[model samples]
Target: MNGASALEVIEAHDGTIDLMVTDVIMPEMDGPTLAKEVLKTNPSLPIIFVSGYTEDRFKDEIGDNAHFLPKPFTLQLLAEKVKEVLS
Candidate 1:
């Protein structure tokens, strides 16, 4: 889903959100911006950013709880990263 919809879902849900996986480039809002907003409410939430852009481009913008997954990654890699972050 797009950032706005994702934000809405986060706001509406009462259950815990284990992780947030978002693309760096998205319509309406970028992933980093979305992460910042999400953190305001869920500061401890973990985020995984998947993007075609180089990691250096946005690495500093996201905090320690966030991970960057460069695009063209395999599903296995994604799963592993998620597991790593959640662990």
Candidate 2:
């Protein structure tokens, strides 16, 4: 799930997913594409993106409901993001 394209991972899901945390600058089908496609099937799933890049640079790709974490984030921040998405 980590390195695979978001769509590949998403298509593999079988309704057990509650949240998806992905790196924004992936090789294929960036995080946004993955999340967007997943949302088409499961709109309620929470998505959190972690990237070293700026959000504005990827604004057009990310979904409106997606939360973001800038690069160099701490474990606490990641945990907080996950909690926030789930909550």
Candidate 3:
């Protein structure tokens, strides 16, 4: 879903999300923007941003508790990232 829709979902759920996985580039809102918005309320929320571009592209925007996963990743790698971030 798009960032706006995802934000709506988060609001609907009372912002009690454990983790978030988003793409770096999106239509409504970019990943970093979404992350900033979400982080406003849930500061410790862990977010995983996936993109076709390199991580360096978003280094400054991605702050604490946020991570980057390059595109074309395997299920194993995704799982590993999730585990690493959640931990």
Number of the top TM-score candidate: 1
Predicted structure with the largest lDDT when compared to the true one? 1
- TM-score sort, best first: 1, 3, 2
Single out the weakest 10-residue window by summed lDDT for candidate 1: 57-66
Cα deviation in Å at residue 49, candidate 1?
Answer: 0.5
Which of the two, 1 or 2, has more TM-score? Answer: 1
Model 2, 1-87: lDDT tens digits are 544555776688676888878888777566777777778888988888888989999877885767889999999988888887787
- Candidate 3 Cα errors over 4 Å, as ranges: none
Please give me the total number of clashing residue pairs in predicted model 1: 0
Alpha-carbon local distance difference test for all models: 0.88, 0.79, 0.87
Preferred candidate (TM-score higher): 2 or 3 = 3
lDDT of 3 by residue, 1-87 (tens): 888888878878953689999998988988899888988888888999999999887788886556889999999999999999998
The digit string of per-residue lDDT tens for model 1 on 1-87 reads 888888888899999899999998888878888999999988888899999989888788776667889998999999999999999
Single out the weakest 10-residue window by summed lDDT for candidate 3. 7-16
Per-model TM-score on C-alpha atoms: 0.91, 0.82, 0.91
Model 1, runs deviating above 4 Å: none
Candidate 2 clash pair list: none
